[model samples]
Target: MARKPGALRNGAPFRDWVLPAAMEKVRKRLKTVDDGDRQMVTILGCVPGDGITAVEAACQEALD
Candidate 1:
């Protein structure tokens, strides 16, 4: 995703992957900005170390 961020929008692998609700909301919002795909991918990359739950919570908090 870092190398090919557009894949997150059209890639087969991502199409089947279900994101947490908050993350999904963030993704939708990100889609509206320039280089949003790359930004989203950067956020997604944090999951490995931060964990999805933490990321999701942070996304929700940010939304709030």
Candidate 2:
């Protein structure tokens, strides 16, 4: 996949702590979900070699 414009490899602009905090937030949110919903919901964390980090829902559609 092509890289997004103006993106840093090491997760710039945001503080270094932001990625972990975001993952934790997603985990916390999923914890409160029902068992069926929880099965569908997933938190994905990506740490690129360039130092870029990302966290996002992997199964939003399933949860919905």
What are the clash counts of all predictions, listed in order?
0, 3
Model 1 residue pairs with clashes? none
lDDT by candidate, in order shown: 0.93, 0.36
Per-model TM-score on C-alpha atoms: 0.93, 0.32
Candidate 1 per-residue lDDT, tens place, 2-56, comes to 8989999999988978999999999999999999999899889999999999999
Residue 55, candidate 1: Cα error in Å is: 0.4
| Residue-level lDDT for 45 in candidate 1 | 90
Q: For residue 24, give model 2's deviation from the true position in Å.
A: 0.0
Give one digit per residue, the lDDT tens place, for model 2 in 1-64: 1233212222465324344444445544655665422331223323342232423332333234
Those runs of model 1 whose alpha carbons end farther than 4 Å from true positions after fitting are none
